[model samples]
Target: MRFSQILRFHLSNNKWTAKQQYVPKHNPVLEEDIKRLQDFLMSKSNIVVLTGAGISTESGIPDYRSEGVGLYARTNHKPIQHMEFVRFANVRQRYWARNFVGWPSFSATEPNHTHHAVARFEREGRIQSVVTQNVDRLHTKAGSKNVIELHGSGYVVKCLSCEYRIDRHEFQDILNSLNPEFRDAPDMIRPDGDVEIPADYVANFRIPPCPECNGHLKPEIVFFGDNVPKSRVEQIAKMIYNSDGLLVLGSSLLVFSGYRMVLQTKDLNLPVAIVNIGETRADHLADLKLSAKCGDVLPKLFNFKK
Candidate 1:
């Protein structure tokens, strides 16, 4: 059954199931598609896996733009822009306050089967490397060693004025000690571990400065209004150039950073396969496209038991 005009094909009866617990709806069409994907992977020697927020959604994080369940569909909350965080003190205060509340759960999230399957592919020499648009370190947690976090990582915090860096866990402790009175529950958690809290909490929150250099502290992430570091782009381009094929998982590819990889793969005349729940920006370029969740398709693709 199609959902509106978007042509979403569900592989399960439920669209929103817990991570690693996806039950196939037993659609024969989906089964055939899975077989095709398996054959496609078997034919390739070195495959590059590109991932985005959909992979993490099964782990209970809400992304920015899904049909009905995304953060934008659910709320009008906008993420902190890069210039806003740099130019305004209040923006940093709000960002840190929300991040402080959401950090515990976000940090504690475990890797799902999709991540494990990708790691398994690497172990078996079926894939060359991974390029991920997610800030969450689930890919690394799942044992994908050659992951390129194209958007940087939320597990790290760095000073803008210097090379000073600290593990995000360590910074959390500093936040705890400085803001003892500003405690509240979060309404929701974004993909990057940010949440919605009271405006007053943001106003009263104390953002800690870098102890080493008195510089501004920010998560090691490429914010919406910021560009991905050029060196990182070159790294991904090189990876794609060396790989034989591209496997896109769970990403809509709306962001140019992720989408351009697909474009590059096509320009190189390499085949591309996409497994996502909705229409992606690079669908026309894909040699094969399956409208299904990553948790459902990845296990079958890797021959992992459901």
Candidate 2:
């Protein structure tokens, strides 16, 4: 079927229900398909790998719209809008309060097999670079060098007013001092280091200001309704143009920023491969599609020790 003939690529409600009951039943891939991807990678020089949250799910981080397992499936709440976060003090407070509590556990998360596999590939000179949509920085932790963080990282705090940046781990100490009696009321953690704490719990929550100018502090990550910087986009496009092939791992390409890479590669007539459990926006454009968990499948495909 043509790209135009494909259905709009998002998870369906019936599929969500089935996933909840059965859990993680990815479509079985043909042996020839794996061989095709392996051969494709071996033939390419300066291969570019793009990744999304599915690569980090095995590391204990929940994805946003991943059928039954995602945060959107579990909750009716919408993600905090960029305008709301910048404009409203109360919104930021609620966000910070929940995020600060969630940060401890979320930060403790380590790189899984999926991350290691990518890193191993890079080390073996099979891949030139990786571009990730995730804020978790697991790719870096797994020892993948030359990674372009498409959405930036959540590990740093940025002052919206003064342009001051500080490590998120350091900012956590400040948060602890501000809300000593405040503990996380909800056990559920969201994809963006936020939790579902009670409204009452957030009412008196304190969001610390920037030390230099007493400005608002936000996680350095790009929020929904926010635009990725033009410079970053240009840089990523150049990298994609320079690459011989594009390999997408564990991303549905639901967001345009990550999806654009595949589109660019297609436009350039470069070979494209996508490894995702669910339907991706660029599925029709890919030369190969592997519907499997990145952690398990990637290790099987690319063993660095060999």
Candidate 3:
């Protein structure tokens, strides 16, 4: 079913849901959790924060591995691998098609309470910097000062064969122009700005080339199985070394890239705090672990955003 002129697809009932809007619920245990987290924060300064999918789940973006409501749990769709995305024409075509459909809703997502809390904490001189595995770019939007996009952001598209780059907004317009018939089609949006289109209709999806040299254009995010850029890795390593401790928020730490951050902190004998609802790879190593909703716990613990 369509919503006005725009095509809308909802995953739950395989019907249509409302236009995207998100507001976090208040937690009953927030007060006690805040006090505990505050006490934990008191012992650390100049800390490094590592965040993941769990952080954005409250912002209406689904995560990949949450037990009841994650992408991996519900579907067989795998995130595109870097090599496949680069090597195959059909892969790029499909990716861009899904991205084009999902962009409006995904990019329209707002910063949630935990995002603002982290920004406030940074402003108040609590943490040194943020290193995130997410490609959403919501941290900077929430007013975080020092942020390292460990996996890059989905806001820019770059050519694989050239340095030609363009804002995703510009690319959206380009996509609409090239594929007018599909500019608004039935789309089921996902967390990473990819949508679910019918398998048969995908054959007709159009993909635009880089205006400069007709090179392949891909989002700036480091796709799974891709190595993080050397410079980005080096920078994060420096940030980790210059920190007082490590604070992990809303990550399952299943990915080695994110899990390694805490391991380095452990090697340095620094205190590590993990705030997540689910079990993490580093649970045994955490100096403090709080299983709570990030949106509910963070705003209460750090209200400097106002």
Candidate 4:
């Protein structure tokens, strides 16, 4: 089936029922607010968009912090703090194992309407740049030309000891050699990919060493407690600085890395618009809030002339 047909089917069949169910209730935006957002975008020669997991949820990826479906809530796991992963070998192994299993699902997800809308905005010259908290790379897949990944992507694995970088596929081979029994593990496995192997069995699991320097390997994403790379932060800041306004999609901005952009935009006195299903940490900071599904609202709001 064509992609459009698949989207229509999913929308009609209620594949995203959970998301719809959790949609927050907020006062409907007045027509004046809509006009303000529209005028802001129209007036700007350069607009910057900061997006979160909400944008990808329509594509079947779950947001990490959305009520009962959040990663920590659903997995019955605590958030992995950065210090723990860096200091503890077992923690690192567990992290990689979970990722190994979850990688396929994350990798398989495609761009949805919101992503396409952002791409359209860029193509139409309404948007000059995008900064995304999602590591899923949906924006790039949707043909966005310039995107800053605030949290690094899961598509690449880097060795800590030797500083070696390898494609996720190559890392999968290493995982296979170490845990052959888990090579075809079921999808029900943990979100990070580690199977429910007994603690005794875990001892025998041989995490592969870096091909270059025999060092530890880690996913490129910034885990809880890890700081965003300064250079990456600066790049996004510069993008925001140059743009006339900022648009936030699908994020609550609970994390400072995500929230700080709103503060920066406000500091620069730029108009800010947000499209989210729930109350975001930056809600008070926005000039306009569209309390609607990104999939439903973005396509309409950013309809570009082709």
Each model's lDDT: 0.83, 0.80, 0.79, 0.75
Q: Each candidate's TM vs. the true structure?
A: 0.88, 0.87, 0.88, 0.84
Clashes of 2: 0
**CA displacement after TM-score superposition, residue 163 of candidate 1 (Å):** 0.6
TM-score head-to-head 1 vs 2, winner: 1
In candidate 3, what are the lDDT values of residues 155-238, reduced to their tens digit?
999998999999999989988887777844643554333367877657777778788999988999999989889898888888
What is the TM-score of candidate 2? Answer: 0.87
Indicate which candidate wins on lDDT. 1
Q: Which residue runs of candidate 2 sit more than 4 Å off their true CA positions?
A: 1-23, 183-194, 304-306
What is the C-alpha lDDT profile of model 4 across 1-306, one tens digit per residue?
754355445545874573343333445555555565677688787888989888776676666677666555556666678889889988877777666666765687678777988898888888898899998889999999988889998888887776689888777877878787665444335422223545644555668777788777788889888889999989888888887888998898988998999899999999888988778898888888877667666666644422
Deviation in Å, model 2, residue 237 alpha carbon: 0.8
- Candidate 4 lDDT trough over 10 residues, lowest sum: 186-195
TM-score (C-alpha) between model 1 and the true structure: 0.88
lDDT (tens digit, per residue) of candidate 1 on 153-188: 999999989999999999999998898875434334
Candidate 2's C-alpha lDDT?
A: 0.80
Q: Model 3: C-alpha RMSD to truth?
A: 4.0
